[model samples]
Structures are given as structure tokens and as C-alpha cells.
Target: MIISKPNINKSRINICRENSQSLEDIQNQSSSSQNQTPIIDLTKAPELNYKYGRTSEIATLKQWILENHTRLITIYGLSGIGKTALTLKLISEITTQFDYIIYRSLDNLPKLITVKNELKQFLCQSLSKPLPEILDYFKSSRCLVIMDDLENIFQFGNFAGQYLTEYKDYSKFFQQIANSYHQSCVILISWEKPADIETLQSENQHTKTLHLQGLGEDAKAIFQEKDLKDDEKWEELITLYQGHPGWLNIITLAIKELFNGQVYQCLIDEDEVFLGDIEALLENHLERLSELEYHVINWLAR
Candidate 1:
């Protein structure tokens, strides 16, 4: 499992209160008026420590949301490539622009109806009459809805991005979000892009996809933070692991424990790369591959 250090920062929600009003007066206001404050629900989100890089990626996402007003965005990449961290950082930068910010994980494979109903209820909490359709709420208010871990809804041992039979309705929901007019944005985070997303991108200007890649030199910070020595050898180690943050973190622990934080010792044998506990991380990604994909990988290995 990928583990992130606890984030010391907390999301601050600003409430607009009259400057002339006393604190007591604001507190005494009706509960309905108080509920007008934007709702932020990130309970399901993982705590993110200091993120290493992706300055350009964050800027592109911000442009899509703020300038282009894209309705649907799919951010996909291999696990540990910082998809979630990048998104959380993006949200932090642009939180105040939306009236509601909500996050959900599809790891448990919740049905589309259930997800829609919950979001609608949360978005419509301040209204005396809740909107009949989730899209109605999107039209009426600005929302940033982030759904993570969407790979869970996809079929295992199949072509990447094929949704399971039970979860197929999600494709329709996504299409609606992409095609229909809305003032809101829905971001899908997955290890594999949904098949419909590809089709949507071709036809809709508001729909977009971002394929995240390795951090390159920006990942050197991970080693620096771990206080590993032999700075000259850090680039070789990072390249061997493709600058994957999660894998690099696991390797750092192994280096510190077994090599006494000496980067030179770890790099003594250039012919062999030491995986240590990173084997488990690789297995997690490998186990999700289709038969054809597995065969292709096996052929490449030989």
C-alpha cells in the first residue's frame, strides 16, 4: 500500500460575514443563512504531505477549469504517479472559485444512482426544495466534484478502461456530464482512462484528459527529504525507478535501514537494480493486467 505522510495543512473554509456585525451577531444569525457557506467534503481523501512537482500539470488543470470552463476532465496514470496529490493541490489552489467542493472514491464500486443522490443532497442542502436532477444543481451552482479510484469500476483481466457490467451506468452519467451544459466540473481520477472518455474528448471541447507521467528531476526532493547521501548517484537511482514517488519512498526506507543512508553502497552494482519492498508495489499494478497485456509484458521481459 502507498503511504503518505500526514499533511499538516488543513482546508480553510471562509464564511462571508458582515464586517460591521459582531462575532456574536453572526453566531446568532439563522441557521439557514449560515448554511450558505460553501460545503467542502474531503473526508475520503488521503492526507497529502509536501508534493514534489507537477507545477505545469497543475497550471494546465487550472486553465481548463477557470479559463476554458471544461465540464469533464479525466486524469489517468499508473499508481503512485501522484494523480491524487496533483488533484488535491489543484483543488487547494482553486477552492474558493467553486460554491461546493466534494470528493468521492469509487474503490468500493458504489452505484451511479447512489453517488448522484448523495452529491445532489449535499449540494442542495441549503435549498428549501432540492433539485430534481443532479444536472439541475450543476446548472444552478458551481461545483467541483472529484471521483477517485475509478479503476475499481473497471473489469479486471480485460482491456483497460472497460467498465464492469454493473458499473456500466457510470459511462452514461459521464457522457451526460460531458455533453450537457453545466456550470460545474467533474474530474475522474483513475489508473486507466474510461473508454467513453476517449470518445467524448474527440467530440467535445469541454472534455479533456491528462495523462500524468514521472516527476523527472523534480523527484530528487524525495531523496533529499530522506537525507540520503552520495548526491552524485541520486539521478541513477531515480532513473532506475522512473522517478515514481511511492516506489522511491519505499526504496529510501530500505536504503536507510540496510545501507546506512549511503547512496553509493546501494549503487555499487550497476548491473542489478535493488527492488527491495517495491516488488509488492509492482505486483499491485501487474495483477490488474489483462491476459494479452500480461503476455506482452512477459515477452518484453525475456
Candidate 2:
């Protein structure tokens, strides 16, 4: 079982750059746009960046990205459903097939305005090119790129960057990035699949979309391997939480400690799941949904 690092300082960030910055790159940005883009300030939430118990989602997306001609593949699901973790796992797993894999989490990028710069920085590292020339040079090469947790560039709140206006949309830049080369893959992981992404699907065979469902039998086994109290109790809990790996991992970890590794007694106590990580994830997507939709998700999960 892998235990991820806890988050340090998170801000309620609204980025003013033309590109989205990764969590690690938070300090590097000049202008913060907290006043713009309504998504709940994820910068202030805890870091929910662990990858756990979503092997099938990772494998399926991996297969489509590697086998299909499409350069950009989007993985969509509800909030806290492990979209980012799936993409992170794929980047680590698929590196062998490509030159190298580069990942950029759209965790804090509230709008499409910041995609170009974020992606450009990511592309340079993944493709091993100069940052200034990444997009132009990507006309030929093989690389796997992932942008996680992206929302609409068109209709959602205030615009943030010049890239939105310059590139028409992030998808077009990504479309070219993925389609320009013969053997390259670009993946987008989002809470909800945007219509622009759906419409931009390749007419012949260039783009693919993978919708992430909750954990299955294999995933359940993985959950058991992690920190949860017992097979039976954890199984019941998953029924309530929809088998989201990240949330379940934290739940299991908390349960394991509460039982002091006794497993059975933790089951007896029937403690509610932990809220820090799940709350952070919810906060990340809170701006994109209504207040009722937001409350019901985490409230019912308990």
C-alpha cells in the first residue's frame, strides 16, 4: 500500500497566466487570479494526489492511448472518482512505450485560458524540447502527455490566458499536439467531458474518450490490499462511496489505524470515512457544480 504525502500550504488560487501551473509550480507563477474563475479555491484544499486502486481505468486508458491513432484521450468521471490518479498511473506505466511521459495536472487551472503555457511547460519535459518550441516542434515526434482535471474553455466563467483566444481552444492545441505526430498520445482527464472535446473527436480515427466507472472486482481486491479494515466491511463501505480509489484508500488507512490493524474491531466500530482528502477533491470541482450537487456527493458518501 502506497501512502501519499500530505499537502502543505494550499491557496485559493485563481491563476492569471495563459497556462495552468502544476501544484509544484504554484510558487513560480507571477499573477494569481483568485478573483476570477468560480471553481472553489483548490489551492487552499489539501493535496489529494495519491494514485490507488484504479488499475483497470489506467489500463483501459493506456491501451486506447497507445494503440489508437488519436493523440488526445480524455478520461471523464464525477469528482473524486480518480481521474487524475488514473492518468498519473498511466504516465508512470506507459513511459516504456514512448520516449517518456510528461504529466500536468489541471488541478488549479479553472479555465481553458491557462492550458497553453501549462501544456507547453509539460511538453518540453515529456518531449525533451525547448519550452518555447514545444508546440511547433511537436509536429513530429512520439510522446505521451496527460492533462488532468480540465473544465470548459468556452462557457465556464472568466477567461485567464491569451492561449484561449490565440489557439481557438486548448483542445485544438492538444488536437494538433496529439494528431500531428504518428505515434504520440495526449490525454485529458476531466470531471465532466466537455462538448467541445466530444465534437473534436477525430472523424477517421485520431481521438478517443474513456469514461471511468467505479471500481470493479480487481479494484476491490486492491482496496483490500491497501489499508481498509476488512473485506466485508470495506465492500459495504464502497457501496456507499462508489469505489473511488483515492477516497477508499484514505478511508481504509483511517480504518486500519482506528482498528490498530485489528481489522475486525474497526469493522465493529463502523467509523465514518475521513473527509480531508475527499473534501479537497470536492473543493477542486465545487465551482463547476451547484451547491446541492456539491453537498449531496460528499455528504452521501459518508
Compared with the true structure, all predictions reach lDDT values of 0.81, 0.53
Clashing residue pairs in candidate 1 (N, C-alpha, C atoms within 3 angstroms)? none
Models 1 onward score TM values of 0.87, 0.59
lDDT tens digits by residue: candidate 1, 55-140: 99999999999999999999999888889988877876676577777889998889999999889877886589988998999999
List clash counts for every candidate, in order: 0, 9
Best by TM-score: 1
lDDT of 2 by residue, 1-302 (tens): 22222221332223222223233343222123222211111222233454345656666776676665566777888766666655544443444355434455655545445655554554454245464545553454455566664654323332221133433556566656545655666677666775666556745367778888777544566555664545665556667567776666666676666656444564454565446557777666666555566677679866
RMSD of every candidate to native, in Å, equals 7.4, 11.9
Candidate 1 residues lying further than 4 Å off, grouped into runs, are 1-37
